[model samples]
Structure formats: structure tokens, C-alpha cells
Target chain A: MKAFAYVNATNEREVVAALKTDGIALPLAGGQDLLARMKDYIDSPDRIVNVKNALDTTVTSTPEGGLKIGAAVKIIDLYENQQVARMYPALNAAAIEIGTPQIRHQATVGGNINQRPRCWYYRNEEFVCYKKGGSRCFAVDGENQYHAIFGNDGPSHIVHPSSLAVPFAAYGARFRVLGPKGDREIAASDFFTMPTLASVLKENVLEDEEILTHVILPAPGNVRSGHYEVRYKASHDWPLAFTTVVLTMNGNRIGSARVVLGAVAPVPWRSKPAEAALAGKPLNEDTAMLAAEAAVSEAKPMSGNAYKVQMAKTAVKRAIMRAAGLKTV
Target chain B: MSDKEDRFGVSRRDFLKSAGVGGLATAVTSAGVTDVEAQAGPRVIGPGDVPVSLTVNGKRLELRIEPRVTLLDALRNRADLTGNKRVCDRGSCGACTMIVDGRTAYSCSTLAIDVQGKQIRTVEGLAGANTLHPVQQAFCDVDALMCGFCTPGFVVATVALLEKYPNATPEQARRELDGNICRCGTFVRIMEAAMKAKTVAGPPTRQARWGDMGVARG
Candidate 1:
């Protein structure tokens, strides 16, 4: 990595001041992603403001009996929390499936949500893809076995890299962002943006000087949520495709559902058709298959990633089955 | 002659001011920066060679380093501690695993300044002058290592795993060892070593020297 001035901000106000300075300054969260990007020459900042000490790192219960997770809370610590494991099982599952134990110990929630695209073309220096302001997205016609199966109508074909964002979006989590102006809350679904020609450089709506400080989840009343990820390797590999299902049941019938797919799009792709299929339907194998089919009905796979469409459908089916307390095949 | 010019001759101040190099030289010294400290604002160290004091294997050592230097580089280069290997400098291979604040962390990816106040236990601290830790002994007992390049990381991770779960099942052992990768493919024997390894009895003979630096969060 190139040399850069490092400042340890003591508080939020100091962080704001340091970030507002002229020149290229980047907030150093877990540095799991930023440091790698720096080494790869994807991003080189003139100044790095360390915010681990300046922010809160606790997991607390909100007034409405929901959970308020600080941005700096480590992924391992989140899974080990008693209330989180018992109350939010989907989050706990996602946390465990994110990376290895060492990564979870070092990575933080804020960094995970704001991680860069995992497209190999974007990471390598040889191929200057659309994310790097190049003319074309090399993954479109190049080796794209891991490219997006949805949200492909773009100049960028990278997938969202966060495992927690899937479950967080399914549960209607809101992110609290702090900037030079003030703190503003943004829904998790609205935080990630699909890649367009104008906004191909960044994946999220976070400003240069803004930091995501907190993730607030509402109460999961009369609802069951499940997260299932399909990885080729069971040990320390990114998911090929994953799904999180949050189902609210009215007695034996499903009242509403939120089915969000990860690693299939530029953002957490919410399947409205799947939710519509599950609405007021009995939680059975037939309903699960129907919902899974609806979830992947619009997936337009690239050249080499057509297999991911089936994996994405199976992930949705298994997630729904798991939520209904049924054993999946 | 102009009225503003020196009446007698080109005075010393006028001559020096017209040269322009003198002004730049004076600007350098007027900032009150001595030889040791840089002229920058605030008391913090820099992107250049800055003083960093850390405790490794119960020795509180200080070294001059840049902010981008990782803990693995600092330990290997500055302190002559080479037990932590630097394979896969990214967090992928976990070849530079160390116990920081009682948790397994990748020393290659962890900044030396980030864990300034925390307790860091490298593989060298796991054994005594003559004897070895239970996990190390178990690894030797089972002949769990082929090429020893990845031993330090595996040993450190095993030490943490035994601390968390003493009687680890096969599934638990597999989960714990996922962080460290062994290209030699000694995972079968490593699993045997984990199941047979006894609990870490007491404080390590070479305990880490932890100062009250008010632990910096990872």
C-alpha cells in the first residue's frame, strides 16, 4: 500500500472535521476491504481517518424491543450476542456465513455494508472496467461465472458483497448515517443503488464525507426469518447465491413475506413476485417451489453464469422451507 | 533611483529577499520543527518513519515505522520475530494469524498501530524455553505438519480454539480451523491433534507485555 497520513479521531465531531478537509480522505473502518483495495490500486487515499475508537460498538435493545447494532460492532461479536442469536436468527446465520473466524474478528458491520464490488475485473489492475471509469465492463463478454443474474441492464455487472445486508433488508433495517450536515436514517433497501452510467463508480448512496453509524431493526412480531447460502466450498468461500426470507404468518396462513436474494444483483434483489406468491398461501413444499420459481422468473443470466439461476431458485426455496420449520431435501 | 529602493546600496534584507531561496529556508526553520518531530500539526505520528511502541511475547519494544506497515512486517523486520509468516499478505490464507485481545486475527492485515494497546500473542509466546504448549505437543504427537510454513498460523488458531472449546468435536474443529489454510493437506492429522490436545493450563511462560494504552478496537 502507498503511504498515507493516518489520524485517529477521538470523537464524531473530530471525525467530521478530519473528513471535511480538502484532498482525498477515506474513513478507515475495519480496513478489511479498504486496505485490500489500496494494495490492489483500486483506491488510494491521501489521508485515512480511523473511526473504530470514535464510534459506538455495542448491541443494545431499542425502545421497541428491537436491536440497535453499532457500526463498529464486529461480525463475530454480533453472532455471539445472546439476544441476537435468540431473537434474530437470520442475522446470526448470516454473520456466521460471512467469512472465516479471523475475518469476522476483524471486520465490522459498517465496512461490510459499504464494501466495494467483488467483480474480478474491477479488482484487477489490467482490466479497467466501468467501475474504474473505463469504457466497457469486461465481465460482460469475458469470464463472468460470478456476475449478476439480475440487475444486468447496466454498464456494471458486479454483485453486492455484503452477507448481512440481505437479512437486514429482509427485516426492514434502517441505517443511521452521519455526515457533516447531521445524522440521517436511510432504509436498507434504499442504501444500495443499482449501477447506472452516471453512478457506476459507487455502489451505495453514502457520500464521501458520510459514515454509516448504526443499523436499527424493528421488532419481529409474529414473524419467522431464515437465511440460507449456497457455497461451493463449505469452508471460507463467498456464497454463489443466497436468500433470506422473512415471513409473517396469520395463524396457519402467511400474511406477508420479504424474500431478498444476495450475490445475484448489484443490490439486494427483493422478489416482489415471490412475496406475492407467498401472500395468504399455506407454507408447504408446493408454495415454496412456486415462490422460488417466481423469485427467479426475471433473472437474465450472462454467458457463463446460467447455473446461478437454478442455485438462486433453490436458495429461495430452501430459505422458505427453513422458515416454515420444514426439512429441505 | 526609485524612492523605495535602498538609498545606500542593496541592503542585506533586500538582497536576501530578492534571492527567494532565503525566504524558503527561513520558512523551513520558523515552523519550530526539530530533528525528531515533523513540522506537521497535532502530536500524532505519520505516514513516514514514526515511533511505535508495542509488546510482543512479553517484551515491550519500540520501533520507527510507517503507518502502512502491518503488524507482521513490524514484527518480522523490526523486532526480529519471524514466527508469524507473511504468506498471502491479504486476509485470505491466514498465514499470519496472531492472538490479539484474546481473539484470532490476521497479523498481515492488522495494522501495527490499530492494536497499540491490546494484548498480542504470537506463536513464539506459546512455548516455554524448553517445553511446549499442549496444542504444540499434540501437533507433534500426531505428526500434523508436513512443511512448517503454515504451522505458526495453525498453532495460534488452535490455541484460541482450545481456549474457547476444550473438548472440541470434529465439526467444531473443522469450523475453527477454517481460518488457516494448509496446502500440505495435513487437515486429517490436524483434526486428530485438536481432539487430543489438552486445555491450556496456565499463563504462558512468555506472556505478552500489555500496557494500559486503553485498548484500540479492531
Candidate 2:
């Protein structure tokens, strides 16, 4: 690992001021991902501004019935939080499905959502793919088994690694960001960025100086949400394909719906067509199948990842049925 | 108290003799001492002194180290707590499992500074003077360890699991133990040891009442 200066920022202003330096100054949250990246030499910042002590580690319900989760809230805390488990069970399930108990305990919600992609090419310092400012995306032809199947019309093919962000996006969550300019809120859907060769070094839309403070989810009313993940093993591995669904029910018919597929795209792959298929329609076997089919219609799977298409469809079908209070296989 | 006189009332010749080049070189070569005035230029420590305070095994130790110094290094090197072995520093192997604030964490991935104020319980802290913790005793009883290098981490992780989920099922045990890796493949025996420890520790206080109740009500 490369050597770096360390700064312990005690407040948000100190954190932002430290980030304004000329040299690379990485923010250390839970260090679950940042430490791994440093060890891999993927990131060698000249200074690491520790932010674990700067943020509040609380999760509370907003006056408008939404949830406000601090950036430093650990994933284990999210699983054990009564408010999160009661109001956002999908988020709780997603938290439990991350890495392992040890990693979950050390990893924070902000770090998990802001985590780097888990693509093998991106992680290994030896392979300088487009995500690393090289020529092409290595996963396009190389071992592309876990690469993206949707939203891959880009110079990179890595999938988003956050399991919790999918539910957050499905529920229309917003981010409270702090930077040199001050605080601002952004919808969760707008937080991520598609990989473009124009700027290969950037991961998300947040500027290098910006720090995510909290995530705010909209009020839960007439909305049923759930998440289903298909993984290789029960042990805290990343899901091969996962689905998060938020449905508004009108008597027995679906009034509105939002279906987001994780680990299948650069960002959370929102299936507007699938949502349209379920809108104003009773969620039966046929409608669920149609919605599942519609969800993956735009999927362009890379080599060795054709199975993801099927897995994604099954996940979407099960998630839709689950949202509608129907039985799923 | 006079500026012209030596503080200890030593002569100038004696002070010059004590500050000789030989003495300066000896100071530079000493284990933990450095000669500040003998160098031709200001000595630089490099970006290698990252000061971190770690509370490990019920002791608060302050160490100046590199930013890359993992919690495993801070524990085993600075604090001299070698119970948490550093097998795979890349976080794949679980030889460096330790309890931080009532939760099991991979010390290899965890930075020492990150766990400054938290309570860190290493495998060394699990046993008393002569008696062993239930998890440690069960490991010995079931012969769960082969090389014994990974035993400390396994025992610590087991204690953490049982503390959190006292009645963890076999499948839950497997999932919770996924972070720990034993090269000897003593997983079955380790599972047995964990289960045995669970029984010896008994169910948690909340679940004990349910355990006393029969199937049928009055």
C-alpha cells in the first residue's frame, strides 16, 4: 500500500476544507471498501480524511413519515434498527444480504451505497479497463459472467454493487450532500453515473469534494416494497441478480409500480416498461410474467452472462408478485 | 534559574563531552532514540507516523504507525496481542477476527484508527488466568483446531456469534462463520464446537423463558 497523510476531521467544514487540497484526499468512512482499494493499489490518495467521526450515526423517521439515515450508520445497525425494520423492511433485508456479519458490522450505509463497483477488472490494478481510463472495458470479452446485462451501452460494463441502493431508488430516496458549496439534496436515482470514456476516473455524480451526509426516503403510504436476490450462495456474496419492487395497490389492481434490477446494470436498472405493464392491472401469473418479460426486454447481456437475463426475469416476476401480495415460486 | 548557568549545574566541558559525535551516533543507533542535533539536515520521518489510539483487550494503547497499518498490525505489532493472527491480510481469510463493540469485525480490513474508541476484545482476552471461555473450552473439547493458528480467531468469532444470536441454527452458524477461513478445513468440528458452546452458554435470557414453556397452554 502507498503511504499517505492522515487527517481526522471533527466536523463537516473540516472535511470539506481538507478535500479542497490539491493532492488526492480520499474520505474514509467505514474503510470496508476504501481500505480494500488502497491495499489493491486501485486508489493511492496522498491523504485520507477520516470522516467516521464527523457524521452522526443515527436513523430516524422524518416528520413527513420518511426515513433519514445518517451517512455513518453501520449496516448492522440498519438491520437492527427498529424503525428501519418496521418502515423499510426491504432496506433491512438488503443490509443483511451484504458481505458478511463482520463486513456488515464494519461497513456503513453511505459507504455501501457509495462503494466502488465489484467488477474483477476494476478491482485488479493490473487490468486498466475503461473504468480505469484505459482503452476498452475488459469485461466485454474477458470473464464477463458477473458483468452488466442492462445499461451497458458504454465504455464500461461493471454493475452497481450496492444492494440497498436499489430499494432506495425504488422508494424515491434522496441524498443530502455536503461539499464546498454547502448542502444539497439529490434523488437517489440521479446519484450514480454511467461509465463514459470522457471521464473514466469518476465513479458517481458526486464531485470529489462532495460528501454524502444522509439519505432521505419519501413517506411510505399505499406502497408495498420488497427485495429478492438470487445469489450463488447463502453466504454474504453479491447477488447474481436482484430485484426491488415498490407497488401502489388499488383494491386488487396495481395503481403504480417501480421495479429496479440490481447487479444487472451500471446503475439500478429501472424497468419503466415493467412498471407500465403492472399499472392498472391485477397482478396475476400472466401479468407478472408479462411484467418480468418487459423488464428484461432491453437487456443486452455480455458473453458468459446470458444466464443473468433469465435470473433477472425470475427476480422481477417474484418481486412483482411479492409486492402485490401474491404467491411466488 | 539563570540562563547563563547549566540547568543541572554541569560544566561546559562535561556538556560538550556528553554531546560528542560518538554519543550522537550511539543515540541515533539506539533502539528508540534519535539524535536531533547531529544530522546535517533536518531528519524526516516520512509519511509513516500515523498516530492511532487502539483500545484492545481492555487496554488503551497509542501507537504511531503508517496509514497502511491494518488493525492486525496495530494489535500484533504495537500492542503485542498476537491472538488475532494475520494470515490473509486481504480480508479473504478470517484469521484476524476480533470483537469490536460487541460485534465481530475483520481486523485485517479494519484500520486501527477506525476502532479508536470502540471496545476491542481479542482472543487473548477470552480466557481467565486458568479457566477458558466456553468457546475456547469447547474448541478444545471438540478438537476443532488443527494447526491452532486459526483457533483464536474462530473462538473469538464464535463468542461474538453466540452473544448476538444465542440460538443460532446450524445454517445461521454456517452463514455467520463464512467470514472465517480455516486452511485445515476443520469446518465441521468448528461448527460442532460452536454448537457445544451455545449449549453450554445456554439460550439468551429473553429466549430462556420461551424454552421453559410447553407446547400446550392451560
Candidate 3:
């Protein structure tokens, strides 16, 4: 890593102000992803603003009978919170399955959601993919095995690398963003943008001076939610395919549902067809199979990622079954 | 199998035992009163050699380093605490795992300046001069290590896991040790050593003052 200056921010205002300073001051949360990028020379900032202690790290009950999680809360604490384990199982499940226990212990929620893309081509300094404002996206023709299979209209093919974003999007959470202008809230679903020729530089709309401070989750009233991931390494590896399902139940019938898939797209691909299939139908094996098929119906895989379509379908079906209290493989 | 390589490869355990005499002698005043007091104010380390004080193994060692130095690099290069190996400099492999502020963390990813006042316990901190820590002794008795490049990191991680879950279940053990990768495939024996080692507790961390745990700057 290159030698850079370090500034420690004392509070939220200081964090935003520090980031707004000149010379590309990047906020350091857990430093798990940022340090790796620095070592790889992907990002060589002049100064690092330590924001781990600057952001709120609490998880408390909101006035609306919902849960409000501070952006800096560690992943382990989020997974082990008794109320979170009881109320939001999908969030808890995603938190636990993120990385190894040591990583989950040190990595923060804000860092997880704000992490950069993990494309091998992008992570390597030589490729100079489109995300880096380069001439072309190497994944277009080069070894694109782990590239996106959905939302492939992109000039870039890097997948969003947050496991928490899947469940947070499924839960309809909103982010309380802190910026120099003040706080603004953005829905979790709309926070991630599809890659375009114009907006290929960043995955989220968070400006350089803005910080995602809090994630406010409205109470999932009478809802059944589940999350399942398919990793080639059954141990600690990034998901090859994952799915999260949140269904508002009306006495054994699905009133509304949100199904989101990860690692198969640039953003968390919400399968509207799967949600429509589970709209008024009862969740059983047949309906789950139908929803699974609908989830992968529109997957446009690249050359080496066609297998993710089937794995995503299995993950969708298993997530629905797990949400319904059924035995799943 | 080179004779020169075998003779000069000094483990952190032996290095610490040798350096303990000189380190404790210099720890008389704790990095000077004014320097320690400067930590409470605003900290902005710049493109110079910044003074950093670390409480490693209950001994305070002061070093002037750059802000970009990681804890692993500082300990190994500056302090000569080479017990913690640097196998996979990224956080993927846990060769540089160390206990910081009562939590097991990847020292390769943790910046040295960011962890100034926190208590750090590395693999070298586990044993004493005349005796071995139970975890180390168990590894030896069970023949859990081969080639020993990754032993110190695995030992530190095992110490953390056993402290968190004394009688760790098989699943919990697997999950906790997933961060460390062993190419030697000595996992069965390593897990056996972890299970056999007694529930060892880490040194008690200094509790923050009342109402002072809120925004820890640097």
C-alpha cells in the first residue's frame, strides 16, 4: 500500500466534511475491502478519513414499531441481535453468511453496502475495465465466467458485491444518507443502479461527500422472509447465486412478495414474474417450482455464466420453501 | 533443505523471549506523558513518520511509522514479532490474524495508526519465556503443524475461537477457523489440537470510561 495521510473524524458532520476536502479523501469503515484495493493499487487515495467511530453503530426500535440499524454496526452484532433474529430472519441470515466469522466480526454494515465491485478484471490493476473509465469492458469478450447473467445491457459487467443489499432490498429498507447539504433518504431498492455507459463509474448514487449513516427498516408486518445462497465452497466464499424472498402472508396465501437474486446480475435482480406468480397463490412445492422457473426465465447469461441461471432458480425455490417452514435441500 | 535457512529462521516465540528483557525496561513511562496526552486531541497523521504506541502483550512499544503501515507489517518489520506470518497479504487468508481489543481481526487489513490505544495480542503474546501456552502445547502434542509457515496465525485464531466458545461444537469450530487456509491439509489434526486445548481466556481489556465509548476518534 502507498503511504497516505490519515484523518480521524469525530462525528457524522466531521465525516462528511472530511470527505469533502480536496485530494480524494476516502472514508475508511472496516478497511477490509478498502485496504485490499489499496494493496492492489486499485485506489490510491491521498488521505483516509477514519469513519468507523464517526457513524452510529446502534440497532434500536423505531417509533413506528420498526427497526433502525446504524450504518457502522458490525455484521456479527447484526446477526446475533435477539430482536433481529426473531423479526428479520432474512437480514440475520444474510449477515451471517457474508464472510468468515472474523470478517463478519470486523466488517461493518455500511462498508458491506458501500463496497466496490469485486470483478476480477476490475480488481486487477491491469485490465482497466469500463468501470475505471477505460476504453472497453474486458469482460465483454475476455474470461467472463463470474460476470453478470442478468441486467447485461451494461457496458460494464461487474456485479454488486454486497450480500446485505439483497435482504435490505427485499425488506424495503431505506438509507438515511448524510451529506454536506443534510440528510436525504433513498429506498434500498432504488439505491443500486443498473450499469449504463454514462453511470458505469459507480454502482450507487452516493456522492463522494455523502455517507450512508443509517438503514431504517419498517416493521415487516405478518411477513415470511427467507434467504438462501449457493456457494461452490460450502465454507466461506462469495455466493455464486443467492436469493431472498419476502412474502406478506394472508393466512397461508401470499398477499405480496418480493424476490431478489444476487451474483447473477449487476444489481440485485428483482424477479417481478416470480413475485407475480406468488402474488395470490399459496406457497407450496408446485407454486415454488413455478416461481423458480419464472425467476430465471429472463436471465441472459454470458459465455461462461449460464450455470448461474439454474443455481439461481434452485436458490429461489429453496428460499421460498425455507420461508414456508418446509424441508429443503 | 538449506542449512543456512534452517539456522536463521527465528520464530516469534524465541524472539519475544529474547526481546522481553529490553522491552520491559523501556516501558517505564508509557511513551511520555505529553505524547500520550496528544492522542486525546485531533489526530491527523501526514506524509511523515508518525509516532505510534501499541500495547502488545501488555508491553508498550513506541515506533515512528507511516500512516499506511498495517499492524502486520509494523509488528513484523518494526517490532520483529515475526510469529504472525504474512501468507496472503490480503485478508483472504488469516495468516496475520491477531486479537485486537478483544476481537479476532485480520491484522493485514487493520491500520496501525487506527489501533493505537487498543490492546493487541499476537501469536507471540500467547506464551511466556519458560512455558508455552496451552494452545501451542496442544499443537505440539497433537503434531497439528507441518512446515509451520501458517502455525502462528492458526494458533492465534484457535486461541480466539476457544475463548469465544470453550467447548466449541464442530460447526462452530469450522466456521471460526474458515478464515485461515492450510495448504498442508493438516486440518484434522489442527482441529483436534483446538478441541483439546483448554478454554484459554485473553487478557482483560481496559474498559472505557463511563459515557466515553461513543465516538472514538482514531
Candidate 4:
């Protein structure tokens, strides 16, 4: 690996100041992804701003009865956090579903949510696709088995890799961001964007000078949430398709619902049709099947990823059923 | 330079003539090989070397290494502790598994500087002079190791699993060991060893085990 200058920023101001400079400063949180990329020569930043020492790693309860998860909170911490387990079990399950025990212990929650796309072509550093500012997307005609099926409008087909972000969006979590201007809050749903709308080279709306501070989850009440993932293999592999659902039930009938799909779209694919199908209806096997069908109505599968449609349907049905405390069919 | 070489050449022959008598005198004085053949020169520490202090096997070691050196490379190269093998330099393989601050981590993927003050336990640190660690004993009893190349990592990972979940069921053990891979296909034996270790270790303290395989309550 090429040698680079390592800078340990003392505070948010120092981090933003360093990021403002022109020399390509990469922020290092858990170093789970950044260091690997550096070793592979995929990213050779001249300087690395170490944020592990700058941010707090604690997970605390907010005054509003929600969780305030620091950006540096490790994935293992999230999996074992008592408040997170009680308030958002789906988030905990999603955290556990990421990588392995070692990666979980070292990877931070903020890093996981902001991780680059896991597209094979983008990660290889050899394929110069449209996401890398090239003329065309390699996955469009090449190996797209893991590409998006829902939110691909053109030039890029990479899917968002964060399992936690799906549940975050389902729960309507908000992000606390720090930048050169000042601190600002953005909803998690708006934080992740599509390639067609945002810059093709970037995955989210985060600027190079900004740092994600913490994630704020609302207070738990009548909300029932769960996440289900279907993957080829369970170990250190990205999910083929997954679903996260948050439902507010009026006794046995669903009052409001939010269904989000992961690894099947450019962003967490929020299915309004599925949400509409669940509203004002009892969460039964038949209703879940209808919701699942509605979730995949607009899915346009690539050449090798038609099987993911089935996987996504199954995941959505299971997630909704689990959230409703119903058994799988 | 020529004059210096001529002077050194004459002194070398004179010194060699007296070296045999001096060698015998020194050997008699020290009762060992006094004129042993020269081996290799010492390795030089480079400018990029940084001082790192780590606690390994309940012992503190201060080592000088490059900032980019990984924990696996430091343990295997500088410390001469080769138990943690580096199979896949990526985090996919658990060949470089080690317990860092009571959690299992891939040493190959972890930077040495990142774990400055953490307690690191490698496979070599598991056994004493007379007794083996419980996990190691179980692995041996169950014949869990084939080819033995991945045994050290598996043993270390098992130790971590047992530490976190003492009463892990067979299915929980399987899921917890998912991070570890055995190319020799000793997964069944490894799982057996893990279950046996859980039986010997008794119940977990307070943490609940995740995954559908185990129905154990916290």
C-alpha cells in the first residue's frame, strides 16, 4: 500500500477543516472498509482523517425516549445494546446480519450506513463503469446478478449495501450531520439517494466535508418493526434481497405501515403500494401475500437477477408477518 | 581507499594468525563457541516505523513497526508469533482470528495501531506448559482439526465464542462459527468441539444468543 499521512482530528471543526483542503482526505472511522480499499490500491488518499478518536462511541437514550446512537458506535455494540434491542429489534437483527463477528466488532454503525456500494464491478477497481464517471454501467450488460431491480433508471445499477439503513428508514430515523457550515439534521430516508438524481459517483447526499454525527430514532410506541434477509450464503456475504417493515397496529388491524426493501434498489426501496395494501386490514397470510405481490409489482429484473424477485417477495411477506406477530406460511 | 584496503589486508592476516589462539582462550573462558561463524546482519528500523504497545497473552510488548502494518503481520513477522495465520488478507477468512479486548477480530484486517491498548490473545497463548485451554482440548478430543492449518484460528474463535456465550447450543455454535472457514472441511468436528466447550463452560452470564438455531434464553 502507498504511504499516506495520518491526521488525528481533535474535534468536528478540525475534521471539517481538514476535509476542506484539496489533498483528498479520507475520513477513517472503523477502518473496516477504508483500510481494505487502501491495501487493494482501490483508494489511495494522500491523507486520512482519523475520526475514531474524535467522536463518542456511546449509545444512550434520548429525553424523548428514543436512541441516540453515536456515529462511532460499533456494529457489535448496536447488536448488544439493550435499548436498541428493546426499542428496535429489527435494527439489532440487521446489525447482527452484517459481515462476521470480527467485522461487527470493528465496523461502526455510521460506516456501515455510509459504506460504498458492494457492486462487484465498483469494488474491483478494474471496471470503469458509469458510477465511476465512465460512459456506461458494466452491470447493465455484464454480471448484474446482485444489481438493483427496483430503482435503476439508467447509468448505474448498484444497490445500497446497508442493512441497518433499511430499518432506519422504516422507523423514520434522523441523522445528525456536522460540516463546515454547521450541524444539520436530515431524515434517513432523504439521506440515501439514487444515482439518477444524485451524482453517479456518490451514493448519498453527504458532501466530502461533512461527517455523520449520530442517528436519532423516535420513541417506540405502538410501532412493530422487523427485518428479514434472504441471501445465497450467510457468512460474510451481502444479502440477495431483504425487507424491513414498521407497522402501527390498531389492535389486530394495521393503522399505518412502511415497507422498505434493501439490496434490490439503488436506495432502500420504499413500497408505497405494499404499505397501502396493509393499511386498514388485518395482517393475515392473505394480506401479507397481497402486500408482497404489491411490493414487487414494478420490479424490472435484469438478466440474471429474476430470482431476486421471488426472494424479495418472500422477504417482504415474512417481514410483514413477523412485524404483525404472525407465523410464516 | 586503496591505502586503507592495503592496511586492512595486512592487519586481517595478522589478526587471523592470532585469532585461533584467542578463540581457544575465549572458548576456555566462556565454555562456549567463541569464534562462531557470522550469520546475518541486523535489520534496520525505518523512518516509517512507529512505536506500538500491545498487551498479548497478559504480557505487554512494545514493538516498532510501520503505520501501515496490520496486527497479523506484526504478530507473525515482528513478534515471531506465527500462530495467527494470514490466509485471506481480506476479512473474509478467519485464519487470522484473535481475541482483541474480549471480542473475536480478524487480525489480518485490523491495523496494529488501532488496537493500541487492547488485550489480544492469539492461539499460541491459549495453552500452558502442561495444560491446554478448554477449547483446545475439545478440538483435540473431537478431532476437529484437519491439516491443522486453520486449527489455530478456529481454536481462538471458539475460545471467543465460549467467552461470549458459555451455554451456546449446537445451532448457535454453528452460527457463531460462521466467521471461521475450514478448507479441509472439518466444520462438523469444529462444531462438535464448540458444543463440547459450551457444555464444559456452563451458562452464559447475561447476553442472549442471536440466530434461529438456538432457542436459549438470556
Local accuracy of candidate 1 as per-residue lDDT tens digits, A1-329: 77877888776555555554444567777778777777776655556778788777999999998999988899999999999888889999999997898999989988889888778987775565667655689988899999899999988998898999999999999999876567789999998899898777678777546678889999878898888899999998999999999999999989999999999999999999999999999998899999999999999999999999999999999999999889988
Where model 4 places Cα greater than 4 Å from the true spot, the runs are B1-47, B199-218
Candidate with maximal DockQ: 3
Write one digit per residue (lDDT tens) for candidate 1, span B102-151: 99999888888877878899999999989888999878866789998898
Candidate 3 local lDDT, residue A79? 94
TM-score of every candidate: 0.88, 0.86, 0.88, 0.86
Which residue pairs of candidate 3 clash? Answer: none
Clashes of 3: 0
Clash pairs for candidate 4: none
Q: What share of the true interface contacts does candidate 3 keep?
A: 0.29
Higher-ranked by DockQ: 3 or 4: 3
Per-candidate DockQ values are: 0.13, 0.11, 0.14, 0.08
Report the lDDT tens digits of candidate 4 across residue range A1-329.
55655556656556555443334456777777777766755455555666777776899889998989988899989999988998998898799899988889888888888777778886665564555444568898898999999877866888898888999999999998876557789999998878862367667777546788899999978988878999888666889999999998899899999999999998988999999999999978788899999999999998889999999999999998888778765
Global CA lDDT computed for model 3: 0.81
Between candidates 1 and 3, which one is better according to DockQ? 3
List the RMSD of every prediction in angstroms. Answer: 12.8, 14.0, 13.5, 16.7
lDDT sort, best first = 1, 3, 4, 2
